[model samples]
Target chain A: MTSAFALSDHDSAQLPLATELIAVIVASSGGAARILTIGGGDRLPSGPLESRHRSLQSGLRAWVEAQTRHQLGYMEQLYTFADPDRTGSAPNVRVISVSYLGLTRESQKASFSDAGWRDWYRYFPWEDHRAGAPPLIAAAIAPRLSAWAHGATTAALRRERRQRADITFGLNGHRWNEELALHRYELMFEAGLVEEAHRAGADLRERAGLFGRPMVHDHRRILATGIARLRAKIKYRPVVFELMPDEFTLFQLQQTVESLSGRLLHKQNFRRFIEQQQLVEETGDIATETGGRPAKLFRFRREVRIERAIGGTKLPTPRS
Target chain B: MTSAFALSDHDSAQLPLATELIAVIVASSGGAARILTIGGGDRLPSGPLESRHRSLQSGLRAWVEAQTRHQLGYMEQLYTFADPDRTGSAPNVRVISVSYLGLTRESQKASFSDAGWRDWYRYFPWEDHRAGAPPLIAAAIAPRLSAWAHGATTAALRRERRQRADITFGLNGHRWNEELALHRYELMFEAGLVEEAHRAGADLRERAGLFGRPMVHDHRRILATGIARLRAKIKYRPVVFELMPDEFTLFQLQQTVESLSGRLLHKQNFRRFIEQQQLVEETGDIATETGGRPAKLFRFRREVRIERAIGGTKLPTPRS
Candidate 1:
């Protein structure tokens, strides 16, 4: 390491301070990224930290099932912090958020009436470009955003605003990255396209499809944060394993990626990436035909896992 | 997103009639992951989620800071509702944990005598293999673990335990993944190398090493969750930007990754990763050199943030 802690003029100082946690729960089905929803709000299942708990996961598990009534199969910690001077709820109180990204096989449907679940894409309609991106990118968002860009008082500000929109929404022919989920949300929020911004007025809120479903408070922002993290994560680590069944077909796997990304991939390149990576193993089982001849079934190879670090699996996801 | 929500023929619904949350905090200098402590306990900052608050993160922020004066920065949601059964804590009372991951710059040193922060590696010394992994791995761990594997009563149980240990600790010649922060902790807990479970018997606890520091409740475990998440995250996204000042040199950027990951990356590879990914832009500035060449100071390329999603970046680390 460039500078080990032992040699960094460091101290074993402890801060008996407050911290916060959050959760990002995602499951996939029907070629779409689905987040477990509660009470019609697209919030990931979350709660508060307590002294009585034995561990963080234990606390997270309790929170998830209490609302959803289903045990979480795969769970991992996301991020942590104490936001300085965050006002609105408790007076003069400090808040911390510890977030988690959860993945599970969707076996339970919404049972009770009050409790509800929805497709993540429904909230972020523009994310779905599986059918080659919607016309809104060129026709609607660009024109309105162009006006917004010109509205900037200074040239530097205008250029910055234009660049932000272009990179985030992939205007000017940049490849759309499925991973910029959080950036995309923030960009829309900045442009007053989302409902959260009271500044948007009713017209933009109703017409701006670029803005996703409005969330309670920052829940949507938090969801976007999780999506951004997950989008970047699946490329290097075997985290996709958490979202998959023990045994599944490549098509199902690819569909899950597309769903979370809200964009389509070059099929041939994707297959080549999977095959070359040796990420999966032939299970000696075959699935009934979906299109062409019956395809072979495969399971994640447990050994290739230890052979490399975060990446070695050449995922040939073409930008074209 | 095949079939948004899959309904199983068998209906088994689990409901969380109650809620809870936890916070995982980290402050790093050089490259060491910092752990939060309470009453001298190596634990995560935490509290219960109650109706007294308006939003989840807000509630968490309030509780944590109420105890510690330190304000947090760069917080993200970790995980949600972890425990399914209310059996771990109080009976018949449902709970949910909206865990969060937090980062602090640590501008001020810890003043509280009873509360403190410590290097995360001190607890998991073997994790920091920067100058080649600590000898404890093969010398102390492998042999004892083999006996534990053999200690299982049934043959199948023995195999299961052995497989788990191997995968977790990378025993019998397995490559270690620093990102498996939680897995390493869970493995230590299982192996009885951690102080939490072994302290009941003095010898076991002592042998665990500066091994695992005891956390108040499950806070340390929550910290582990945060460490693992951050380690994995730094690879793709520019989250390190959150922790950095407005402008910094490539060396400073590299040191941060080394500290958090506790593993070194090839320097050339790291620089190449930063350049090709276009994560940073030159600010027309240069920093005075301490030794070799004065490194060019660069600002995070806020515009190119979306580009990272299309491709992953490498860190300037010396590969182990």
Candidate 2:
């Protein structure tokens, strides 16, 4: 059994030694945008850093193959960090982790035995802005959060609470910027309305209910991290290609972006930007069978890839 | 003695065992954009995941505070991944890690016995677009990378190599996008021109002398991660506030954004965007005497922060 309070501040300071990786794999599925997860958990495919690996990229591919067995379409290193105390009970144990985000087609959604896939919006229900803010956001959360903000003792404190609440959960005519996923999650967590709190022996289920369902461990929070990165990414990079199929109608691609970003795009402008940037070349093939008018199929130009590969392959971030 | 083998295929099936957090802390020091580093290494701060920790944010704050003692502002989890065989000899051991990015105003630099700060431009010399790309870009790197690209034996490979080099290093009638910081570093690293390899087993004199001295470990690589993130960040979020003092002139703020992003902004367009967004408010203050017109001081609108905490801050992503 673990020692009583084996994690004193001094001892606690020495834990968390393992280094790992997390990836956010996004794709369109069932006409709805979905994020990839392993074993129904919000975690993306990840593994540890090993010295045997030639470089970080190779090591990442090896682990990814071993777990999912599907070839990765595209991958990039997101970031890396280390734990001072080493999460293991051993003292001076340090682990270094490097994380990557990968993209694959939903056709490869084959599940791994210990893995499962869940919708990203399940964890961040408020993020689905396609149809506008869900009613629960206004009727359930707004008023409750307002009450909580007013619960502060002094006027200044009350104002500060209101400001924080309003910012984290867009209030008083402030437009909800879908990208503050992590901050919004943190605010809910601090308020003791997250599942991790119950695991940690604190209870804020009543408040947590206003947010959304929490995940096992830090999974929900990690999902927020990936969503924020992806939301910010779609604006400037051609990374949307990774989530797209080889042959896609421009509208299909546009909807995918709109779906993940939780914001609708102006069709003409979106089409004009994509065309001007030369992100896609017309396949000369049209898909008229499924829709009103035939839309041309476009293949991601593997050429602009050269110039935009680093900064991005897209022009005009999705600005309304 | 440490264990000899820590990785096996079966060992890989289990989820990553350790979670690590790497942080890219950026600040302006002495008129130059600088990156924070630790342990006399190349770049950034990092730590591990612990069961004792309440959540990822608290865990990261604990480790970061231990070193810098400065509370972080504007933090976002960057990525997470695990490498089971990171230790080389250890085979069965696995680790998981979560990475994060932190932004803060430069203060009294922390005193890490082995750590020091370096100007970010020193690493990617070509990125300094404050005055636009210097002649050195064409004179120094273009020819070398061009030759290397054409050095491939097969025609197919040669053309690819050429294209990759041209776009990555901005060669042959290409515009330089400052956002490709990581691409630039990786390209140079592969070319064996940077000082980092020389610090390893590679010889110093034989190195291509591309740009900048190298850090002791993978610090340069981590530095690239930070650079790429900042370059992408400036385009969307109001994170520039983190680098600014409590109050500042709009011009000073623009300079900071341009400095980190390595791109010049159309002053009129930038000001218009700022004003229209309602992201800032006059502080009823003014400053003058820099041999130019006196300017009003403004603090970020604490309220509109509720409006665009995520993608509210716009980046002048060049469509030009």
Quote the lDDT for A78 in model 1: 61
Residue range B25-105, candidate 2, lDDT tens digits: 778744578776666545456565565555677777766666656567778765544444332223444434355677788
For each candidate in turn, the TM-score is: 0.70, 0.76
lDDT of 1 by residue, A1-320 (tens): 11101111222221122333355678787776778766566556665544434456766676666666767876766655444433134644445556677877776765443345567766676677778776766776677778888899999889978877777777897667677777777777777767776532445454533555776556677777777877766776666777787778888888888777766678878877888788899899988866877878989887665443333343456445
Cα error, residue A150 of model 2, in Å, equals: 3.1
Identify the CAPRI category of the predicted complex in candidate 2. acceptable
Off by over 4 Å in 1: A1-120, A148-161, A189-253, A276-279, A283-294, A297-314, B1-71, B79-100, B109-117, B199-204, B207-210, B241-252, B275-312
How many clashes (backbone N, Cα, C below 3 Å) per candidate?
Answer: 88, 54
Error of 2 at A267 (Å): 3.9
